[model samples]
Target: MRFNTAPAPHLAPTASTRRIMQWVLVAMAPGIAAQLWQFGPGVLINLALAIATALLTESAMLRLRAQPSRAGLSDWSAVLTAALLAVSLPPIAPWWISVFGALFAIVIGKQLYGGLGYNPFNPAMVGYAVLLISFPKPMTAWLPPTDLAATPLGLLDAWSAIAHRAGPAGSSFDALAMATPLDTLKTQLGLGRTMDEVQSGPLFGALAGKGWQWVNLGYLAGGLWLLRRGLIAWQIPAGFLAALGGLSLGFYLLEPQTYPTPLFHLFAGATMLGAFFIATDPVTASTTPKGRLIYGALIGGLVFVIRSWGGYPDGVAFAVLLLNLAAPTIDHYTRPRVYGHPG
Candidate 1:
């Protein structure tokens, strides 16, 4: 008896990589708008600069690697990476900051490791982490929300601050900037202040931080849009938020004076963006349904641990990078059984 040896038929999905990336860009619009409203035009400028730098670096690396530069560049992966890195940085971060970040992300973080899919870490997070570590003062000098700023930075002032390295009247960017809620909380808590005291600080506001709360809300809206469009699976974000919220609630219930509430944990930092977008990167994240839940939950749990006890005020980048390292292991164990396979 002769047996037929034929390849399995390919099943078509409604979306392509390009389409997915386009949707990702569209989903970022609400967040981008919020940043613009709260922070001024600096955010848009940084995004443009970062995107240009990323495409240039991506093309250069692809050519050097003897790959098709146009094809690689057209995929918009580098653009997305640049956008994420840019948005995460202080809006008025010096020009070189975005430039160096784009270069590091495209070259060392992505290409040097054998290009996009082969890299173990998320390129954008790698770039952000490096910049944060190297330029702590500049990176942490986030602008107080428009309502809190003694002098809201105008377009020209913002431009001058970022471009000329000085604010109006010889003041520095530092004079016009304030700490993020996470940074504020970390320092105050380290100084033995209670959670209530920290929440009442100048940096804190009705929702969370002066301006950061609006930014987080913007990202939250954008993330919800992404979910509505089905660009991402609900498993990762749902699992991550559930874990983070549950853990924070447990801690808060155990000691209200010491621990921040779930709202603070959810809206204070990069929790929403990380949960909906960053942690759900299909390439770097787990693929199987079960694996995705495990991956997301692990990230959320790690985020709580890091925020509560670790050095970093915000744990999104650290948590995502750590979980990226374990994705393969997660996939191995969580693989779904074949339909006809015997258990």
Candidate 2:
């Protein structure tokens, strides 16, 4: 009798990667629904493009490497990577943006490092970082909330905007696009405006930004379910949110006029998604329990620092990538004690 061998970076000893990826995809449904309601059909468009591109790219790469495409394509890792990257993108970005980003993610970020569990960085984040660096304008070309846009985009309108790289007929891209809440706040504070003044602006919402609070809530709900299902560990998200919220609270209390509130930080920009979905990536994240907390807290700290001082508005992707490099060190120092061994 012969047993088949598989690749590295498996989610767990008990769970197959396909099942884990399925749960993750299911977990994102509510968030995707929120995105559609708030931002229009851009998420779906990007997701379609990314999923297609990632699958094809991964298939080709597998064949080139003489690996079985059936084993890989069935695992759903590529699909999960694409979904994460797709949702992170500007909803109405050019069609090529998703295609190119997904290609790079599967080709370089994952396969180049020998695929799946062997890759140190999160493939989705690697794609996002490259896109942000190479195509900053398109990456940041975000549509305002459905209620805020001059013309609300239907499915065909979204398809048109993505394909043509402009807004619907008679509307300019400028009418549809706006800076995200994090960006707006960063710019306003730089201009010496008070937080109150900024919060009263059209883009600001009750908790975070218009449409953003609900989206975060949607993801938060799914994340909690994931926690309950034991698909993900509790330490990572807890430490991440706790540290981010703690830091935001300290700064907001110190200078309420200068900083956005903890609620804003928690609900705006990719805080919940990054904390729950992205940081909980088993392959790239810390393996040891204590290390997971430290890893998460450090990522949270980096996110705050980058948002406040770094060039980017949101720092989740960069924060995750940075710590991906440090995961080994963290796990080394945080390893649990051996039951029978003592110093």
Model 1 ranges with Cα > 4 A deviation: 1-13
Lowest lDDT 10-mer window, candidate 2? 165-174
Each model's TM-score?
Answer: 0.94, 0.95
Kindly list the per-residue Cα lDDT of model 2 for residues 71-180, writing each as its tens digit: 99999999999999999998999999999999999999999899999999999999999999999988887888976876679998889889986668767766777889
Score candidate 1 by lDDT.
Answer: 0.86
RMSD, one per candidate, in order = 3.0, 3.6
lDDT of 1 by residue, 149-250 (tens): 677777788778878877877786568777788888888889999999889877777767777777778888989899898889888998899999999999
How close to the true structure is residue 199 of candidate 1, measured as C-alpha lDDT? 91
Top lDDT hit: 2
